[model samples]
Target chain A: MKISNKKQTLAFLKKHFIMQLATSYKDKPAVAVMLYAVDNNFNIYFATHKDSQKSQNLLKNPNASLSIWEHHSALIQASGVVSVVKDAKEQSKIMDRLADAATEDESFWPPVFRIKGDEYIIFKISLSWARILDLEQDTIRQKDTPFTELNFK
Target chain B: MSETKKALIILNDSDPVLGRVCKNKFKKQAGWDTILSSTYDEAIKIIVQKKPGFLITDIILKNSVKDGLDLLKFIRESDDKDIAKMPVIVFTDLGQEPDKKRAFDLGANEYLVKTELRIADVIKRIEKFIS
Candidate 1:
C-alpha cells in the first residue's frame, strides 16, 4: 500500500495494535513492547503500571520514541513528548480505542487488563515528528530518500 | 427534568466572586451543575462522595494546609480507579512555566492561568473537555 499522506499514516496506525516504545532518563534508555491506540490526531496511547521502568523514566523525562513495523512490509518511526492522560473521560475513551484495536481472537485479552493490584497510568504521546518506510513499494531504492517524513507539529 | 452533570470548582476564600461567577457561567453555558470547595481536603471529600463529572481547581488555597497540587496528586493516586482517573483542570493565578509543568506532571488534564486568560476563555477550555 502507498502510505504517503496523513490519512494513510493514520490508517496504518489504526491497523496495528502493538508498538515498541523507547524512553530514557539520565542517559539511561529502555524499551518496552506495548499495546497502543492511536487517535485521529495521531497521538498514541498506552497504559503501564506506575512502578514500571518506562513509567518512571517518563515521569522524570517525557521525551520518547516509538516504532511500529510489520515483517518486510512497512515501518513507522516517531518521537513525541509523553503526558499522563489523567482525565477519567479521556482515559475511558482511550481504553475503548485500545480494546477495539486488540487482537480479534475472542478468548485473548491483553495482560494489562488482567493485572489486578498494580495501578496503571495512561500515557499519551503527542507526536512531534514521524516517518514512514514503505518497503513493499521499494521507495527506498528507487527514491533519493527512503523516509517519507510526516509533520504533526 | 433532565439530569445535569456536575463540575466541582476548588477555590480559596480570598475571592468568592470568581468562584460564583465561574459556577454561573458553567451552568449557563454548558448546562452543568456546579459544586464548590474551598480547600484540598474538602475537595477530596467531595470528589469521593459526589463523583462530579469534572473538576476545576486553583493552585493556592487560603487557610488550607494543602493546596491544589496536593489535591491533584491525591486524585491521581486514589485507590478507587474512577477517582484516580477523574478529569481535573488547574485554574490558577500561577502562570510560571515551572508551576504549569508541575501541575501537568501531577496529572492535571488542563492548566489555565487566571491572569493570562479571560473568564470566557477559561469556560470555553473547560467546555471543550467536558463536551
Candidate 2:
C-alpha cells in the first residue's frame, strides 16, 4: 500500500529488524540480509565483514535498494545511495547499537559476523525514495494505492 | 560504555509520515530507538518485550479496543517497577483540563498538547524524561 503519512511509515520501519539490502557494482548485483538501525533521516546503518562482497560492491557503486517486510507482508522497499561509515565516533556508535541489538548467542558462532573491531564495515544507506506494498490486502486497494515516495535528504 | 536504549511511541493514527517524524526525532535528538505502535496490543507487546526507556503517547486513539489511557493503566498497575515507573509523556491533541487531570491521575510523567508545542519542542520535552 502507498503510505504517505509519516506516522504509519515510521511505525512500519521501527517495527522491523532485518532488511534485505541490495547493492549493484558494474554488472553484478548482490543482496544481503542485515540487521539495521535506521536514523531519523531514514539513513540505514548495518555492519558487515570488510572483505564481504557487498562491501566491495558498494565501493564500486553506491546505488542500492532495501526490501523490508513484516511476517512476509507489508513490504517497505527503498532505494538509496550507500557508503561506508568511516567516522570513528559514528562507527563506534553504530557498532555499539548493532552489538546491543545482536543476540548473545550470535557472538559464539562467528567473530567476523559480529560488529566488533575494525574488521567489519559499517554501511549507511541515505534513502532517496521508498514505497510500501501490502500483498496481504485486497487487490483493489493494492492497485488503487500508488507507491508513496520518501524523499528525505 | 553506556547501553543503547529504546522508546515506545503509541498513536491511534497510522500515518506513515508522522511515524517517521516521531521516530526520527527520538532517534536523532535523544539517541533512542523509537518504536511506534498504533494499536494497544502492539504497544503492550513492545512495552513488555523491549521495556523501552520511556513512552510517548496520544490520549484519544481511534482504536476503541484500548486507548492510550488503558496502556497507562497497564503500566502503572503492573507489578514490575521498571514498567510501572517508566516515564510517560502524553503527546496528544486532547488538551482539556479533565484530560490532563485524568492523565496525571493515571501516572503520566508529562503531558503535552499537540498544538501548543512544535515537533522539536515535543522532542525536547521527551529528552528531559529520557536523558
Candidate 3:
C-alpha cells in the first residue's frame, strides 16, 4: 500500500499490530517486537514495564525508529521518537484494542502483558521519510550474504 | 563462579537444538565457545572463571536473574575488568528500543534481534570484534 500520510501508514500498522521497534545510541542498535496499536491521531502505543531497558533508553534518548509490516502484501517502516505514558486512561484504551494480542495463546505474546498497572511507552514517530514497499516489487538488490550492506542507525 | 574462556555467554532459551546450532556456528571465528546456561547464576560463575573473549547472552536469563538485563548489571559490578570489556552480543527473540538502549547503556558490544539474523550471520558479526 502506498502511504500518502502518517494516518494511512499507521492504518496499515493497525491491521497487523506487530512491529519491530529499533532504538539506538551512538553506533549501537536495539530491536524488539512490539504489539503496536494506533490511536485516533495515528499515534502508536504499546505496553511495557517501568523497569524495562526501552523505558530507560527513552529517558536518556527519545528518538527512535518503528517498523510495522507484513510479508504477504507490504512493509511499513518509519522513524520517530518514543514517549512514556503515565496517563492511566490512555493506557487502558490501547490495551483493550490489543486484547487478542495480549493473550497467552499467541505465537509471539509477551508475559509482561499479563501484569497490571498499565505502565507503557507510547512511541510517536516523526518520520523523516518512509517507504511502504511490496515484497514482490521490492527485490532487495543488495542480498549477497544476509547481513551484507545491512546498516542500522 | 569459574570460567575457562575469556568471555561468558548466556541464553534463556532451553531448546537443545538452538544450543547445538549456536555452538556449531560459533566454533570457527569465535575461537572460544558459547557457554550454555539456563540460569543467571550459572552464567555468572562461568563468566567469573573462563573470562572468555565476550559474553553472547540472551535477553532473558532463566531460573536466576529475571532477564539478561539484570545479569548485565552483575557483570559490570564484578571484580574482573575483563568481564567489563567482554562485549555483550545479545542474540535473543527480544528486540525493542528500550531493551536495545538498556543493552547499549549497560555496555553491550552489539545487539541483534534473532529474527533478523541467523546463527551464521551472528557468527560473522562476532568475528569483527575478534579480528
Candidate 4:
C-alpha cells in the first residue's frame, strides 16, 4: 500500500529501534547494526566511538544509507546526510532516548554507552528520501512495484 | 498578578526600531513580554534571570565579546536543564546553508533569514512555538 503520509513512516521508525547503517568512504563500504532513536522530524540519532569505522567514514563522507526490516512483515530503506551532534546537552538527550529505545531488548545495550576509554560521539542522520514495503498489508503484491516511497527533500 | 511570559531577542547592535517592534507586537499579539539584548553577556544574564519562554538571536554581535553563535552554544550547553532546553530561534542576515546547518547543529529550534522575512512573519513563527 502507498504510505500516503509522514505519520506512517514515523510510526514504523518509532516501532523499530534497530537499523542497519551503511557508510562509505574512499570507495570502501561498511555496515553496522545499531540501536537508534528517531525524533519527530525524522532525524535518526545514534552513538558510536570516535574511532569506529563508521564514524571515521562519516567524518570523511557524510552520505549514508540505512534499512530496517522485520521477517516477512515490513521494510524501510532510507538515505541521508549524517552530521555529528557536538552539543553536550543535545548529546545527553539523544543518549537518553537511545537508552530508552534499547530497553525493549533486555539483553542488548547500545555499545557506545558500554564501551570504555574512548570518547563516544552522537551522530544524526537527516533523511532525504525513504521507501517502505509493508508485506503485512500485501496491497501491492499484484503491482509491478511493491514499495511506497517518500521523498523528504 | 499573573506574570506574562517573556521572549528575549539578541541582536548584533542596538536597533531601537526592531526592539520596539518585537516588544509591541509580542505583548499586544500574544500577551507576552519581550526583552532585547545586544551583547552575549547581557543575553546570558537575562536568560538566567528572566527565564524567557523562547529566544530570538542574530548570528553576529558587533559589541559583544562573543558572537551570537557562541551565545547559542552556551545556551545549548548550559548546566541548567531548563535553560539548555529553552527554544531558540536564530534570526540572522546570514542566509547561507552552512550557517543554517551550524545553527541547527547547535540545537537552534528555528532559523530565519532576516532579509527574507518581515518582523511580523518572525513574530508569527515565534507564536507557533509559544502558543
Candidate 5:
C-alpha cells in the first residue's frame, strides 16, 4: 500500500488525534470533540452524547464537517461532510461494532448513555474529496550541489 | 524539530496525488524524511515489524473491513505495549465538531483536515512537535 510520496502522508496520519466536528445552526458555528473510529471501507465513525450541542446542531442542520490533523509531522489534514445516523437499530449495530474495536475508555457508557431510553450516536464522514500536504520534507533546495539558489537565511 | 527526524506514513487508500502533497510538505519545509502507504492492514504490519517514532495514517482506509480509526483503537488496545503508546496522527476528511471529539475520545493524538491544511503549515506544525 505504499504510494509515491508516501512519506509525508503517512507522517501526517501517524501521531495525531482529536478531530474537530463542525455543525451550524442558522449559520452559527458549533464545534465539538469526540472519539472516532475508521473502517477499512474508508469511512470515519464516532460516538457522542445525544443531548450534546453538536447533536442539537445536527438535529437543526445535519450538514457538517470534521477535521483530523496533527500538530507535527508536516501539514496533513482532512475535511469533509458528515452523515449522521439517528435510527436506533442501525446506530446500535454500528456502535456495537465500534465498541468492539474501542479501548476500555472508548467502550465506556455514560449515565446518560440513552436518552428517553434511546442512546448512542454514530456518524460517518465521506470524502467529498481529499488533499495531502507536507512542507517538512523540502529537499530540492538542499541537493548539496552548489548552484547559486538564493537562501533567505 | 531540528530537521533531524524521519517521517513514516501508513494509509489504506492508494492516493498518489495526496501522498505527494504530504511528502513535499515535510521533506521540503520541515526537513524530514517521509514515507506513505495506502492500506491499514499493511500499515499495521509495518508498525508491528518496525518501531517508528511517529506515524501518519488515514482514519478512513481502503481495502480493509475496518478503517484507520479502527486501526488506532487496535493499536491502543493491543497487547503490544510499545506500539499502543506510539504517537499517532490521523489523516481524514471528517472535520465536524462531533467527529473530531470522537476521534480523540478513541485515542488519536491529533487530527488533520485535508483541504484547509497547507504544505508549509503542516511542516511548521510538525517541526514544532518534533523539535
Candidate 6:
C-alpha cells in the first residue's frame, strides 16, 4: 500500500498493540501473537518466554516479519531483523514506556511482562519495510492495493 | 523481616553491555538489588562496602587488574566472616574442563558457561542460593 504521507503511517502503526510475528528456521515456520510497542524510528519491541519456540527460532535466525491489522479497515505487513536488548538500563526504559502504553488496562501488564528476569527475553525488531493492505479500499474500490516498501520516518 | 539480598556482578569494563544485562536480570527476576564491579580493585571495594549476599563473576575480566580466580580465592580466604562465606556463582565463557574444575576448586558454589547459560537457569540457581 502506498501512502503519500509518513505521519499517517506512523499513526496507523502506533494505534495497534498486537502483532503476528513470523519466523522460520531450518524450513520450519512459526508465528506467534505478541504485544509490541513501536518507537520513533519505527522499531518494534516485544518480550517473549525465553524458552519458547519463537525465541529459539529467532536466536537461530534473526530474520523475521510482523503483521498488524484490524478486521474492517487495514493490515500492515513489515519485515524485521531481531536482536536481544541486553542492556539493563535500556530495558528498564523500554519496559516503562510499554507499561505506560498499557496503563488503561493494568491486568494486561504484570510482573511477567516486566523485563525483570531470565524467564522472558526482550526483543527489538528493526523494521526493514512495510506494506499496507487497505481492506476497505480493496473491497470498495474493487482493486488490489498492492504491498509497498515502507521508507518513512 | 529479613533484609533484602544484594548481588554483585563483576565483568570487564570493555564488555559493559553484558554487565548491564546481568545486573538487570538479577534485579528484575530475583528481586535483588545489584551492583557492578568492572575491575579487580573496584570489585574489592564494592564487596567491602556492600557485602553482597551473592556474587557472580566471569572467568576472564579484560579490565580486571586481578583475575576473577584471584578474587574468588580472596573471598574464600578473607578474614571477614561474611565475605569469606558469601555464595559465589561463576558465569563465564571459559568452557575448558580445567577452567571449570579450577573455579569449582577455588570455592565457587556454581559455575556456568556464558555460551550455554540461560537467563532462566541462572535465575533459578540464584534463587536457590539467595532465597
Best by lDDT: 1
What are the per-candidate TM-scores when only chain A is compared? 0.89, 0.80, 0.68, 0.89, 0.58, 0.81
Q: Ten-residue segment with the worst summed lDDT in candidate 4 chain B?
A: B14-23
DockQ of 6: 0.03
Q: What does the lDDT read for residue A49 in candidate 6?
A: 71
Residues A1-153, model 3: lDDT tens digits: 544455655567666767788776666667777666666655677656555666566667878777766664566666666676667675545555554343322233343433443234544444444566544345556353211111113
**What C-alpha lDDT values do all the predictions have?**
0.80, 0.73, 0.61, 0.79, 0.58, 0.75
Query: What TM-score would each prediction reach against the true structure?
Result: 0.51, 0.47, 0.42, 0.51, 0.43, 0.53
- Flag the better candidate by TM-score, 2 or 6: 6
- lDDT digits (tens) for residues B1-131 of candidate 5: 46466567864343332454455545544667766666777777777877566777777765677887887888889787878887777766678888788878989888887655654555555554474
Off by over 4 Å in 5: A1-153, B1-3, B12-14
The residue pairs found clashing in candidate 4 are: none
What tens digits encode model 1's per-residue C-alpha lDDT throughout B77-105? 98999788889999887899999999999
Q: Tell me the lDDT of model 6 at A16.
A: 71
Instruction: Give the worst 10-residue stretch by lDDT in candidate 6 chain A.
Output: A109-118
Count of clashing residue pairs in every prediction? 0, 16, 21, 0, 96, 2
Q: Against the true two-chain complex, what DockQ does each candidate achieve? A: 0.02, 0.02, 0.01, 0.01, 0.02, 0.03
Q: What is candidate 6's CA lDDT for residue A53?
A: 81
Model 4: native contacts recovered, as a fraction: 0.00
Task: Show where candidate 3 strays beyond 4 Å.
Answer: A1-153, B1-7, B28-31
Instruction: Residues A1-153, candidate 1: write the lDDT tens digits.
Output: 667889999998988889999999998999998889888988999988788889999999999999999876679999999999999888767755665555333333455533433466889999999999877764446655657898888
Worst 10 residues of 3 chain A by lDDT: A144-153
Computed on C-alpha atoms, the DockQ of candidate 5 is 0.02
Q: Candidate 6 on A27-120: residue-level lDDT in tens?
A: 8999988777788788888777787788999999999998888876677888879999999888766765554444324234332333323355
